[model samples]
Target: MPPSVRRSVEQRADSVGFIAVKRAANAIAEAARDSNSVRLSGAEHTAAYLLTRMPATYAASCKVLDELRGVPVASVLDIGAGGGSAALAAHEKFPLAREITLVERDPLLAEAAREWLPAAHILAGDLRRMTTFPPHDLVIAAWSLGDLPAATVARLWEAARVALVVIEPGTLRGAAFVRKVREELLAAGAHMAAPCPAAMPCPMVEPDWCYFAARVELSSMQRRIQGGDLSYQDERFSYVALVRDPVGLPRARILRRPRHHPGLIELDVCTAQGRRSERATKRRDRDAFRAARHAEWGGAV
Candidate 1:
């Protein structure tokens, strides 16, 4: 999270107190384990999310949006925008974005988003009932759409003038949701923009799923709220980006963190043809070995 956003979140969280935020954070975590939708029914819940979850989500959003560096994103619409984390990340990625909009069901969260992004248009309503949405260059649903039906994804795709990105938890269920959306959009003529090297059916089998981890810096307040001593946390997430038109996609995407061995690095990647293992050995290819040594999970190879 940026310093400005971090300060703002701290200011809000300070008012709720540590004990209140801690309790709310635990409740929120428990609820998330059981349901797909976020439950922000009170101020404490909202404050807890801002302090504990927003930073990780923002970090993940930044990482995911980085893949769209070359894409022209003049406008962005964040559905189910909780505290405007994804929207804030979008603004950072596309500073020239002319228009920004956010849809949130929880009034408290909607107001919080408005406070965070004063220039954005905030819609305080349920996304499930919304019949239509304004078209935008990029439409993102971060940690959203897991519970929504396939028709919701179609609606979101229709509103996406350039691309549609859906992010979810890294659990098996989350991977299933992402795969479902990917197959649906690909069948509708959409092309891959990130993560997937090809549009072919996901070669990943049932036991092994596709997911990535984003490391996030934890604020002091967040550390207390989470009751953790670590200064950083790894947030696992699964996402798919579908563009309206064909784009230059990567030849292969590293599926997991590279494994370092004696003078060699092992990479599990998804290629245009299928999934396979590629090796980079210092004795064979110094350049590739150097790149693989610095390679991160979910990066292009």
Candidate 2:
């Protein structure tokens, strides 16, 4: 095989691979929106999410690894793989990588991904409820870490081989969780690359959400899951925060952009002059907090 022909063959293969991944993402997005697979959220404090929520979640996941890190790892473990969007993206970009594992908690999502992404395998397991997980060169947790109990977060951090990147929805709690994780990792002597490159301190504050995107390919099972269509695009920009607090974390910055998704949020936690107070039960409960803070710190300053 001549070098030019070999290169052409490899390029052709890459194009085919790209198409297959895109097909899978489209199916997952469509299936999630499917009424038959309708997953009602039953009013869980936040809006009804998943299945049909943010479609572009695929690109965001790829960004977490490729451009953001600008470095490659031999292995990747995507915990709570969701619809397998990120896993497929990683496989597409790192064609020669050693291994890529997609860990999903929901059986249906795993099943859908199995057919959607033959190149990338799927595992049905819960990060919060798991006893043990195999170590990998890199770990990516997208929008699933905050839902996990605090104790599990600590345990998972300890188990990471190189770096653990945790992404949560762009919310106050999500941004705050990044700080908490950083503190935990730093206390353990893990490196802190960019504490919050997406924002100065943290972008997960009130009403100031930042965004980014990446190109994600589809899986075979995903196409079967959604009836083999490609008109729709599978994109997402949920709140993303990258933390490389592991042994050899790299330097990066918080990314900012505009998109269909809502930005950062502002909540009325209602504190008393930078002092902790009893938890408030009702909206009015914050009034007392405001008064307390104003009395001590001169008007919520």
Candidate 3:
């Protein structure tokens, strides 16, 4: 990530959601301790999905905030504020906010965050156990909700006043997380933030159906790590997010011949959050990125 992006991410690490990112990153790092394979693969996989959906995700989050009657987010809370990038975006977008509290669990990472992040109020503790909670009008959890025990998320949302945003991976696991939160939030009476995955026979039809993207500007470090030399347009990957209401249903703009890939859904960027349609990919190009890495040497991802 660039200094600007890194700076942006670090600036907003005060929220619990953003804090949890370090813990999750630690987990992934641990899982891939042998090599950078796990981290690299995971990052690439996730970026792919988030890049394309950035517009939608960004729009949805803002929409959710709006539905909350435009609450003045004086104090904000980011759970799983990994690297505080998302928090930074929020900070950039909402600067007048008084305080941004990031709650991260990993003490090592939290300490690192202190050195790396000088702007936000970074705190360390298991968010699930938090009591006597501080006042925070906004709460965000992107790609972190799935790692947390389901009950923990329910407990935290009870404190959220203005809005609660949960970004999950665009996979079965991600899909499940999205559903779980949507159900839990509705049960808790939280309002809907984003539209449910509309349409059926999801594009992730067969071999090539599992991917998502986020629009992001990459940093030289990220570019180097990813073995790239240019600015990333749409970071692509496979992702799935759970929302508050109407459960996410797949929405297809133009139906193409569905492909089958065992457990994948064949789909594309059709009606991007109701904006535009996209072309579905052919089977050969589905998992093309998989051959780029190796477990011994980055898993040829």
Candidate 4:
């Protein structure tokens, strides 16, 4: 998370007491474990999300949007913009973006987003009921499409002039939603942009799902509220990026972190053909070995 955003979150946490935030955090976590969307109604729940959830979500958004660095993005629209995490990440990634709009169903969250992003147009409306959205170069539905109807979700793609990104939890249910969106959009003429090497059926099967993790450094207040000993957490997320134009697609995408040992490197990557494992050794392929040794999860290989 950016420094400016971090400070803003911390300030919000301080306003809410630790006990109330902790209780709300536990409730929110339980809701997620049950694969249920939480409707945060109180200040405690809102603050809990701002402290315990927003940072990790922002980190994941940053990682996902970084892949689209070369894509031209003049404007961004964030659906289900909880505390504006995705919008903040987009603003940081695409500095050239002139217009940034965020749609949040929760009025508190929308007001909180305005505090962080004063120049942005934060709209308070339920995305499910909205029939149409203004077109933008980039449309983001991060952690917001889970409960949306298929038809409503389709409208998000329609609003994207250049690209659309949908993100969900790393759970099996979340991956299922992402897969459904990927298939539907691809059939509608959208092309795979990131994390997918080709516009083909997902190679992952029932037991395995496509997901990535982003390490987020927690603030002191965040650690206290969550009751964790560690200073960081890995935010796991599943996402699909679709673009109107297919350009600069990679030959393969690393699905997991590379394993290195005894001068050998192993990469589990998704290729155009299917999911496969690649092995590289110093003696056999020095260049490939070097690249694999430094490769990260969710990177192009």
TM-score of each: 0.98, 0.53, 0.54, 0.97
lDDT of 1 by residue, 80-173 (tens): 9999899999999999997999998888888888876899998888888988888999999999889998888999999999999999999899
Q: Candidate 3 lDDT, tens digit per residue, 130-246?
A: 763454666776545566677777656765666566655555556555666666666666654333334222333333333344455553433443455667645322322223333
Predict model 3's lDDT versus the native: 0.46
Question: Per-residue lDDT tens digits of candidate 2, residues 1-301?
Answer: 1233223323433444544534443454454442212332222100112222323455565555554354445677777776565665566566655677788766655554565455665667656677667776567777666656667666666556666666554444555666676667656655543323222233234554433334344333333435657635434333322344332322232233211112221222222122222322234555644433333211121
Worst 10 residues of 2 by lDDT: 41-50
Clashing pairs in 4: none
Clashes of each: 0, 33, 82, 0
Per-residue lDDT of 69 in model 4 = 75
Which should have the higher TM-score, number 1 or number 2? Answer: 1
Q: Write the per-residue lDDT of candidate 4 for residues 1-301, one digit (tens) a residue.
A: 7788778777777788878888988899988787546789788889989889998889999999988878999999999998999999999999999899999989888888998889999778888789999899999988988988999878988899999999899989999999999999899999899889999889999888999999988788778866659998999999998899887889899998888889898899999999999999999999988888789999997
Off by over 4 Å in 4: none
